[model samples]
Target: MPDIISIGEILIDFVSMESGVTLAQSPGFLKAAGGAPANVAVAVSKLGVKSGFIGTAGNDPFGRFLKDTLNSYGVDTCHMDLTDEARTTLAFVSLTADGDRDFVFYRHPGADMMLRKEKISEDYIKSAHIFHFGSISLIDEPARTATLYAIDIAKKHGLIISYDPNLRLNLWPDEETARKTILSTLNLPDILKVSEVELEFLTGIRDIDSGLKALKDKTSASLILVTRGIEGVDYVYRGERGHVETFKDVKAIDATGAGDAFVAGVLYGIHERINEFKDGHMTSKALQDILRIANACGTITVTKKGAIPALPTIDEVKRFLSERLER
Candidate 1:
């Protein structure tokens, strides 16, 4: 049985090395595996965890490549679906000279959004220790309902629920609907991960503390993790709260999947019973360990250039930890 089950979109990201000066401007593109949930699965697997991806993809070349990539990373794809209605979702990312990115989607209701309620098998969700999801699948029909249904089942089975609002403004019809729906589901998660910008947008509060308070008051999630680029991660647990600084000084090439890596690190540490020092209580020591490991993972991710491909192996993470410890 898989220890982690991630349910949501699985697609291809075609990132541009150059910026678009105009609508007709074309830049050199690099194809890579992407999708928030898929990245989580790869991250978990690379960290020596038993992880699985449950979603749909097109019956096309890109879809096959996605499937093959997941298997190569040691993620179980037994619950993956191949659909004929739509092609795989493609995201065209354009990066500026400052390393900022803007995205243009090529989604016309792709296969990932076509995941059906019927395709969600009960056995799959019940077997996992944690169930993870994001908001992209909540933007569309069949998939929207399907994702919610699976969450319900996972909750019923008493699994730890993790959510990431991983917001994409281009995918949603309107900001209001996205804000309402994403905020509404916050209460259902045991752990929540959101970027600083996401916290602001979701709560309509510019201050991190105010936004975090609003989220906690609404969701009552046991743990709330807020990620800040370069600065590192800020976490709020039931009994502990603080910021964990970056593990090392490393030049970041692409930060596409750094948050996902942090999530994977948190889950990995928790699953290995590394938090036992806290004895089920959110003690300061436990929080420190979690933060340190998570920072190391995130730092490793940024050193590489892609999402899934950037996930570090166990040895790599250990080396990072050792290097940091020696400093």
Candidate 2:
């Protein structure tokens, strides 16, 4: 049985090396395997966990490349669906002077968004300890309903549900629809991971405290992880007070996939029974250990490039932690 099952989009990212350039305008572009759920699967696999990914991709070369990449990373691709009707989703990412990213999507209801309810295997959902999903699958048709259906089955089977609203604005037709739909699914998740900007945009609350409260009140999720780039992470449980921890500084080459790497670390810690978050209480020591490991994973990912390719192994993470401790 797989330790974790991630269900969502699987696609290719065409990233520009230069600023103010689109895929067409850039002098050079790099093709990399991407998509949030795929990244999470790679992250989990890199940490020595049995992880599986379930999503649809075209029968095209890009889709084949993605599947091959996932298998090479040790992620089980048995559940991946391939169809010839639609092409693979493509993301064109442009970097700013300060390393911030802007995305342009080339999607006309791609294969990932065409996932059908019949394609979701019962054995796949029941065989996993955790079921993770993202917002992209909620943007479109049969896939929207299919994703929710899978979540319901996973919850009924007593699997822990994890959500990451890795929001992409360009994909959604309107902000209100995206906001409403993504907010509605919050209650179904046991753990929700959101970036600072995502929290603000989701709740319309500028203050972190207020935003956190608003999300908790709305979703009733006992565990909430809020990631702040460079400043590390802050987490909140039912009775425990939230706290922020800073991480050691490193020369970050690319910020892609850092959050997914952190999520994988937390999941690995939970799976190994290292630091489990209780129903109503979480100890500070436990939280600190979780953050430390997560920070190490995130830091290691930034030192590399790409999303799935950047995920660090368990030994790499330990080595990073050891070096940082010595410093």
Candidate 3:
């Protein structure tokens, strides 16, 4: 059984080969496997943790590529479903001069949305110490119900639930629906990871103090993590707040999967110290250690391109930290 299970979209990202090119003007593309939950599953596996992915993909070539990618990275894909009903989802990514991206998705009821509740494996959900998910899966029908069902099983088994909004407004009918859907599930996870913008947008508050206060009140989650690009990451855990500064001079080529890598680092930390976490002995020092590694993971990711392709191995992360410390 894997230590962690991540469920959500597993799709192909067609990245523009030329920098600062729009989708219309871009000359070529490079295909890579991507999806928040799937990226996290592969990230954890790269760090030597047993991980499993549960999602739906088209029974097409792209879907097969994604499945093969996950297996190559040591993620168990036994729970993944292949459907002939729909083609795989695809995202065409064009980048700005600064490596920021624009996305155009081609998923008119993609295979991922076809994940029925009946297809979910209850035993797979229970076997993990942690279950991580993203909000995108909740936007659709059968996948939505199946996601909630998996959460219920994880909760019943006392597994730590992790939720990342990984908000993509375009996936929803409107901003109102996206906000309502994500906010409704805020309290479900024991650990929550959000972007600084997401925190403010969800709470309708600009200041971190006011915004987090509003957010904490809504959730049974004990830990709330907010990531600020380059400005670093901050958190509120059990009423205590802390922040960690990011590494300087990143020179990022692409930042697509940095957040997922960070999430994986955090979960890996929790897996390593499961006893301390279970016993309620998560000291500030322990958290700092985890966040440091998480930050490092994110930093290493952007230096490369794509999501799963850029994730660092545990040894790579250690080497990165050591080099930084020596500097």
Candidate 4:
């Protein structure tokens, strides 16, 4: 049994080797295991915490590789399914001059869509203290229903729910539908991580404070984090708010999965102080420390290429913080 369980998409990422190019301009790519929730799973596991992944991967070469990759990171995949219903999903990523990412997905009917509600085990979900997910799987069927059902189970079992909309506008049929669909379920998670832009899109407010206030009114989330890339994270926890700055001056080559790495850091921090979070007594100072590590995770990730491979281990994160302290 794992302390954390993350459920959703598991796929391959084809990252363009060259920076400062669009997908059409990039000449080549590097195949790597990715998918937001899966990245969180591996990132937490790398921190030496027990985490499990539950989702569907195709019974193909890419899918098999993803399964092996999760295992290599010591992530539990007991409830993971390998299905023949659809081929694995693939996303081609190209980078801008500033290491920002642009994505083009190749999933007519991705194997991740094969995530079956009936196959999800209630006991497995209950075994964990936290359940993490993203909205990508919410874009379609089977997975949508399955995600809802799992959320229901996690809530019933009193697991701390975590959501990072991980919104990819291109994946949706239209912006309005994406907004409406995601908005309808805001009241679900205990923890919510959204980028500053995501909060703006969801709340229709450019002002970060007003947007966070709007989101807080809608959800039961005790903690809401707004990531601003290298600018760092702005957060509100149970009515107390603050900002945490990221590591300064680190060269970035690829920004893929940095958000996921940050998500894992936050979750692992809560996982460490499960009782305090569950009891609604987690202080802003404690959370500040947590976000600092999360920011470190994000910074360390951008300095490398690919998603999973870039995620730092707990020791790696500790070393990073130690070095920063010694500076």
Candidate 5:
């Protein structure tokens, strides 16, 4: 049985080959399996945890590609659903000169959004130590019902719930809808991870301390991780606050799945100490260790290209950290 089960979209990202070009103006593109929850599943698997992905993908080449890619990374896709009603979602990513990205999606009710509540497996949900998800699945029907239903099952089984509201405004009807939907689920996850931009958007606070406080006010999460890109991560656990500085030597070639990689690191850290969780003794020190590795994971990811391909294995992360510390 897998230790972590991630439920959400699993799609392919077509990255523009040229830098500083719009999707329409790009000469060529590269394909990679992406989606925040799926990325985290692979990252956790690579770090030596048994991980599974639960979602729907189109019964097409792109969908097959995603399933194969997840398997290659040691992620179990046994609980996944393949549908012919909709094509697999595709996002065209345009890379900016500063390594940021813009996305143009081609998902007119993509297969991922078609996941029904009936398709989610109760046995599979009960088997995992943690249930991880993102807000993308909550934007539409059927999938939204499925997501909430899974969370309920996970809660019933006492699995640690993890959530990352990897917000993409283009997928929602409006900012208000996005805000309302995402904010409503704040207190649902035992572990919550959000980027700096998401924090400001959700809480209307740009300052780091204020933003964290705002989120804490909204959720009773055991851990709230705030990713700060190059500056590193800010975390709050059991009323203790800490920050971890990111690796400075790594140059970001692309910023696609960096946050997802960080999420994996955090989950892996927690998985390593599942016994502590069972005992209800998740200390601040344990959380800081998790964030430190998570920062390293994000640092390694952006230094490469693509999302899934950019993710580092456990040995790679350890070696990178060792080399950086000795420098």
Candidate 6:
């Protein structure tokens, strides 16, 4: 059985080769395995944790490649289903003039979105120590039901539930629908991770403090982490809050999987100290240490390109932290 299980979409990302160009203007595109929950599972597995992925993939070469990629990273995929009803999800990404990403998605009932509730295995979910999910999969039917059902099983097994909105505005039919659907199940997780922008989207407050306060008022999640680009991470554990500063003198090239890598680090820490968190006992210093590891993992990810490729292994994270300490 795995220590951690992440459930969501795992698909191919077609990235344009040319910089500062749209997809039409790009010379060519490169294929990469891209998905938020899968990235977190891979990152956790890479850090020497027993992580597993529970989701659906298309019955195609791309799906096989995705499975192989996770296997290469030492992530378990025994429960990852492959469906023939729909093709895999695809996202075409290109850089704009200002270095911002412009994305176009092709997921009209993608195989990942076809994850049915009947296909979900309660046994697999019960076997995991922690459960992680994203908001993207909750946009539609079968996947939405499947995700919630799995969460219920995880809860029954006393597993820690971690949620990250991982918002993509374009994927939703409307902002109101997205906001309503997400908040409807917001009270499920023990941990919630979101970016500053996602915080605003969730609570309609731009300020992290007020946003977090509003979220706490709405949800029962005990721990909430807000990642502030270069500013660092602000976290509220139980009732106390703290901040961890971002590493200085670091040059971030591609921030593709930075957030996932950070989440992986946090999950790893929780897995190691599962009893403490389950017992509702944690010190401010202990929480800060977890955030520091997560910050380093994100820092390492931003230094390289791609999601899974950029994620650092356990040795790499330790080396990165040790080098920083020496500096």
User: 196 in model 6: Cα distance from truth in Å?
Assistant: 0.3
Kindly report which residue stretches of model 1 are placed more than 4 angstroms away from their true locations once superposed: 18-26, 274-279
The Cα error of candidate 1 at residue 11, in Å, is 0.6
Candidate 4 on 66-138: residue-level lDDT in tens?
Answer: 9999999999998889999999999999988778999999987999988989988999999899999999889
lDDT value, residue 76 of candidate 6: 92
Predictions in order: lDDT:
0.84, 0.84, 0.91, 0.93, 0.90, 0.87
Estimate the overall C-alpha local distance difference test score of candidate 5: 0.90
Model 3: colliding residue pairs: none
Model 5 lDDT tens row, 1-327? 899999999999999888888888999999999998899999999888999999999999989989999999889999888899899999989999867899998888899999999998889899999999999999998899999999999999999999999999999999999999999998799889999999999999999999999899998687888988888889888677888888877667889999999999988998899888657687777777777888888888888779999998999989987887797
Residues 1-327 of candidate 6 have per-residue lDDT tens digits of 888999999988786766677788889987888889999999999999999998888999988899899988889998888889888888888855433466799998788898889888888888889999999899988899899999999999999999988889899999999999889988999999989988899899998888888888777788999999789999888878788997866776667778999999999888888898888897788788888899999988877657788899989989988898997
| Candidate closer to the true structure by TM-score (higher is better), 4 or 6 | 4
Q: Which stretches of candidate 2 lie over 4 Å from their true place?
A: 19-25, 278-282
What is residue 66's positional error in candidate 1, in angstroms? Answer: 0.5
Q: Which stretches of candidate 6 lie over 4 Å from their true place?
A: 96-100
lDDT for 279 in candidate 5 is: 74
The candidates, ranked best first by lDDT, are 4, 3, 5, 6, 1, 2
Q: What C-alpha lDDT, on a 0 to 100 scale, does residue 139 get in candidate 3? A: 94
How displaced is residue 36 in candidate 4, in Å?
Answer: 0.3
lDDT of 1 by residue, 184-220 (tens): 8987888889999998898889887777887778785
| Deviation of model 6 at 97, angstroms | 7.5
lDDT of 5 at 94: 95
